[model samples]
Target chain A: MLGTTFKRIIRAGVVGFFRNAFVSLATMLVMMITLFVIGSLLFMNAALESTLDQVKDKVDINAYFLTTASEEQVLEVKTAVEHLPEVMAVQYISREEALVIFKERHKDDQLTLQALEELDENPLGASLAIRAKDPSQYEIVADFLEGQMAVAEGEQQIIEKVNYHQNKVVIDRLSGLTASIETAGLAFTIFLTVASVMIIFNTIRLAIYTNRDEIEVMQLVGASNWFVRGPYIVEGVLYGFVAGLFTLFLFYPLSIYMSSATESFFGSFNSLVFYTSNFGMLFKYIVGSGVVLGAVSSFLAVRRYLGV
Target chain B: MSDSLIRFDKVSKFYNGGPAALDAVDLDVKHGEFVSIVGHSGAGKSTLLKMILAELYPSEGAVLIDMDDTQHLSKGEVTQLRRKIGTVFQNFRLIDSKTVYENIAFALEVAGMGDEEIEVDVPHVLGLVDLHDKAEHFPKELSGGEQQRVAIARAIVIQPSLLIADEPTGNLDPINTYEVVQILKKINDLGTTVVLTTHNKGVVDSVGGRVVTMDAGKIVRDDSGGQYML
Candidate 1:
């Protein structure tokens, strides 16, 4: 009986949907627009998150050491820095080596010659380029460098200076922007989704209002609530299903374009591959969520306006 | 005949801020009987029919169908009871989106009748209301009388034990009204109980039956052979 009820309702719903082609078409169009915009936003936000993560991976701290620091002391400091556990890689550059590389690389430029000659000696200190396992731990390396005392005979610093301050501000701003985008993206997604539901609900309500005579007659003739509600709920499900599939269709090409455009920056952006690779999972979530939302909107609208 | 196919046990229905729609109403409807409920508007004739169908539960008393108290029936069970009792409305509430055939088949579908049964039964019911040719016509395509006839076909399609028509002729012309009453009498002759509420005196006087007259939500008269008078 339950199975028959299900089949009957589905049949009636489909028939009812076709009976009022204009309203059903209007509902589908509304759903499509709403779902498409939301899907686009989701795709863009995910891409932004991916690119920001890659950018975060590239931020590092460059610490310049005192010029007079001995190679052995510097090696000891390097070993200690490595042992700090946050440090991923440490490259030690000597002052002479730094000068030689600078002169060799910029021999064609007069500014290079003037800047090198003004130093009077190898004014460049041995610098340790420090990369941490995590970008948030850049300050750990900075504080460690500033705290070293005996490397240069207590000249108020074992290192000349760290150039990461300006870079740090940029990275921090970038990170903050990314965080804000993520927060705003989430908020926008929620707000837009709710608005979409409201639109669909009011559309269904109008549809129901137009057919309220039928609803009241159904009630008068002793139709159950399920019987009365079944067709509209099915209408909502159809609206949602078509909308969701339309959204998927719109997302497909956009995801491809997004992936290709971002491939240069983030190495073959394969979100389409990733999202589609899990076809069963992703499709389940999308269709299930769409149908459920549509059905809920219909159920709520009918209950409020045309209770049996 | 059974004493009553429907019985009201001191049924009273109170609205939110006004006097009760039905004030300590006691009523009886016997099997194969055609009872006309006549009253001035707002005199609770509609409320009485609504109670029989269990649309509105009595505020202070109980209503019984076939001697079974309706108060304890679940919502689903009330629906089942309603399937046995058909209702026609003043507005001729035919589904606008559906064709006349679909509207008539709806009642049989509600009863979960087989399609084969519906195929055989729906056309017969429509023919009984003389609307068999307009099966493919939508409600909007039909005239008010034709729409009311579609409503009548829907009510009778399930072969319900009782039929309740509230101002069924309210929207019809004199000819259509006479035709509608003739159809109701035809259904009653087939041994189905018919309870009709109307203010049309000519209808009541022509199709002489039991008459229950009401005034101020109270039953003022009951006669086996009655007229439309308080």
Candidate 2:
């Protein structure tokens, strides 16, 4: 008995979905737009964060060591800085490497290259470049490095200078900009989801209104509430399921089409690659939200309008 | 235990504190009886039928279907009570999206009948209506008479203990009306208590059983042998 009731409701819903083709299509189209907007936000966030990462990569504290400091002393300082929770990485450029880099940078300036080659010995110090996970936490890494510089290493004063102060202003501004963008994106996504849910609810209410007589007839005939309401819920789920799948398909071509532009604009963040790689997560969200929105809106609309 | 399929005890139904839709009325419909309710518009024929269906509760007094008080039945109880009684309206009220066969099958489906039973019962009812050829056809494809017959088929397919026809033939022509009335008589003969409300004297005369006359929300007269009195 339970099995037959369930099958009948599902069949009725499937029949209703196809029989009312115009309304069903209109519903699916609107839901697709909602899912598409949400999916686009996911891609946009990826691109934005990647661009921010590029900016974060450019600003790090560089500590120059004294020329007399041995490689072992500098290596010890590198390991200590790497142990800091906030520090992402530390790179050591030896005196020879630093001199080579300086010469390469000034190769276009013949006078500077001559000046560099005329030195009695390489005056450049070995340096450590320290990067922090969060641009805002660069200050803590800087303070830690300063404390290391003060240790004196047996009164030799091996650390000559640290350049965090010069880069502090730029890092702080970058951090603030990224933070504001993320907060704003979250708020905008929330607002869009609420609006889409309202639109779906109203659209379904109209569908129920059109079927009001059928609903009344069903009720008057003594169909159990679930029997009367079940078909509508099934139709709602189908609307969401199909729309979610279609929206996913819609993104495939769109992601591929825009992959080149996004890659060039966001500097190696490809939309197509992100879409395929994250397809499982995206399906869970887009399809899941679609089903949730469709079923919930229909459920609520029938409750409010049908009163059954 | 009164052998009454429906018993309305001192029922008074007034809407918005205005004049009563049904005013302090009492009536009984016995088991296996074909009773036709005849009255002009506003005579409370519709309201009284609605009471039996539990669509409306009495403002005063009580309505009992098989000794179960309608006004006190919970929502699920109301539904269970409704399933025992089939209702047909002036409008055919067929789900247009469904075929004629599906329309009849829908009644049994809601009753939780198995598919094998539904498959057999739907075709039997379609054959009785002589719409076996039109089973796959949509309601819109059928004539007015055919649609009314389909409505009757849907109502009776559930084998409801009591069938209420509220102006079931209101939309049909003479030929279709005769066809529908004949079908109702056939269903009543098969032992399902039938309560029908109509404005047609021809329908009352044709039923040829019991007629209850109402005026201004009161039963003015009731007679056996289905005499139509206006």
Candidate 3:
């Protein structure tokens, strides 16, 4: 009996959905828009994360050493810097490598090449490039670098200069912007989710309202509450399922269009690649949300307005 | 009262502190009896039928259907109670989207009848209403008499012990009304207790059975094997 009733309810629901062709179309369209909002937010968040990572890569401290410092001394400082909690990595540039780089830059300038050849020894200093885990931690790394004392003389630092203070303002501002963007992104996602549910809910309510007389008749006919309500729940779920499929298709073209712009700006992040690679996860969330939202909205609208 | 299929005991209903729709009415309908309720507009005929269907509660006193008090039945119990009684409306409220066969099948479907049973029973009920050929047609395609016949088919498909038809022929022409009244008489002969209400004296007088007359929310006259007289 339970199985029979369930089958009848499902059949009725499907029939009901197609029965009111215009209302069903309006309902599915509204659901598509809602699901689209959610899916677009997923892609936008991926792009935003890629851009922030690219920005974070640009802020680091370059510490230059004196000409007297040995390669071993610089290598020792590099190991020490790597051991720091705040430091992410350290790259040691030898005096010869630095000279090679300088010559490469000045190769176009004949006067600079002549002046450089007149010197008997290489005058370029070895440098250690320090990167911190976070942009704001660069100041802490600078403090650690300024604390390094000279090995040969008192009050004479072996490190010639650290460029962290020069670019400190830019790094700080970038860090602040990244934080703000993350917070705002979360807030926007929540607000959009709430608004989308309500919009879809009202649309469903209106659709169900059109069937008020039918529902009353069904109730009057001694239909169990579930018998009356189950078909509509099925209709709601159909709207969600179809809309989810449409929204997924919508993302394909949208992601493809965004891929080039994202690749140019974020350097390595392609929207299409991200979308394809994460299709399973996206399908699980987007379609799942669509089905859940559709069912819940219909359930609530029926309960509150029609008293079913 | 214990043997009565439906009993209304001193039942009174008021709406929003207004005049009573049913005031201090006590009536009992026995098993397999065709009871016709006759009254003018505002005579509380529809309200009495609504109470029997458990659609409204009495402002005071009690209504019992086959031993279960209407006021105290649980939601599930109410559905079970209603399953024992069939209701018809003046409008012949058939589901417009459904075909004639499906409309009749709905009553059995709501009762959780299986598919094979529905397939067998829907055609039989259609034959009873003499609309078997139009089984697949939607309600909109049917005439007034045909629509009311479909409504009767839906009502009796459940095989309810008591059928409460509130003004079943209100919208029908004389010939169509005569056809509908004959169908009701046929249903009553098939051992279903039918309680009907109507303003048309000709339809009521034709029934020529027990007639209960109401006026100003009260039963002014009740005649056994009587005519429709206001």
Candidate 4:
């Protein structure tokens, strides 16, 4: 019995949807626009988060050692720093490797190469590069390195200087900016979602209003509230289903176009890979939200008229 | 009271403290009886029908369908009650989008009849109304009488125990009116209690059944085997 009722409800919904094609299409278009705005915001936030992570990964405190410092001494400091919970990684760069990198970086600068060759001995110092798990933790790591330098014996202060001071201001500003952007993006998305819900509610209400005569007839014919409401809720879900499909159709190409358009800025950061890996979750969210939005709006819209 | 299908006990309906749409009135309709309610435009004939259908609640008294007071019925129960009573309006309120066959089938569908039954019963009812040839035609394409027939077909498709026709022949010509009255008489003979409300003396004279006349929300006259006498 329930199955038959469900079939009838589905049939009614399908008939109503097609019976008023213009209104149904208008509703679907509105839903699609809502989904599109939400999808774009989500994708933008994801790309922004990925880009910020890459930038943060590049930020670390570099500690230079005096030429007199032995390789074993630098390795000992690297191990000590590695033991700190804040330290994500510590890499020791020898003077020879630093010189090779410097030469490669400035290979096109003949003047710089001549100046480098004019030196009698390698003036470059071995350094330890310390990466912290969080940008805020960099200060603690820097303080640890400073204490190590200060406590060194008077005749052999092997640790030269840590570049934390030079990098601190920029890292702190970037972290603060990213935090604010994330907060603001979340607020904006929520605002858009609420506004979209209202629009959908109104659209469904208008659709029901257009069918008021039909609803009256149904009521007079002894259709129960469920019987009258079932078709509209089904229509709402249909709107959502179609809107979800449209969002996916529009999102895929839009994402690709955006990925390429911003390649010069974000290409080296592997933003495309980030989207591809998380595509499944994104797909589920967009489609699920569409269906939920459609169904909820429809249910609320038709509730008042069902009193008949 | 035991055999009554519908009973109005001191029923009164008022709208916003104005004059009553239905005054304190008492009436009973027994099972398988043909009752005609005749009155002028504002005589509360429609309101009286609505009370029986549970579309309107009494302001002062109780309306009972099969001895069950409608004032106490739940919304679900009210719908259930309505399913057993078929109602036809003057405007021939057929779903404009549906064809004749679909219009009748919709009533059966609302009663939760299965597809096979609807397929069989719809054609049977359409044949009874003699609209078998216009099964697929929309309401707009049909004449006024044809439209009323479709409405009648929709109302009776569920084989409701009670059929209420409010001005069913209002838009029909003399020939069409006579045909509709004959159909109502035939349906009454088939053991469905029919409550017809009309101001047409010809309709009341033709039915020649129990007639109740109302004036200003009160039943001023009721006669058995009577004609329309305002």
Task: Note the DockQ of each predicted structure.
Answer: 0.58, 0.70, 0.63, 0.66
Per-model TM-score, in order, reads 0.83, 0.94, 0.92, 0.90
lDDT of 3 by residue, A233-278 (tens): 9999988888898899888998899889889987768989999999
Predicted model 4 interface RMSD: 1.3
Report model 2's interface C-alpha RMSD after superposition on the true interface residues.
1.4
* Predicted candidate 1 versus true structure: per-residue lDDT over A80-124, tens digit per residue: 888897888888887778888888888899997997788667876
Report, to 2 decimal places, the DockQ of model 1: 0.58
Greater-DockQ candidate between 2 and 4: 2
Clashing pairs in 3: none
lDDT of 3 at A213: 81
Can you tell me which runs of candidate 1 are displaced by over 4 Å? A63-104, A107-134, A144-166, A251-290, A306-308
**lDDT of prediction 1:** 0.81
Model 3's TM-score against the true structure: 0.92
Each prediction's whole-model lDDT (CA): 0.81, 0.89, 0.88, 0.87
How does residue B159 of candidate 2 score in lDDT? 88
The docking category that best describes candidate 4 is medium
lDDT of 1 at A113: 90
Over 4 Å off, model 2: A151-156
Per-residue lDDT of candidate 2, residues A64-155 (tens digit): 99999999999999999999999998999999999899988888999988887798999999999988999999889888888977874567
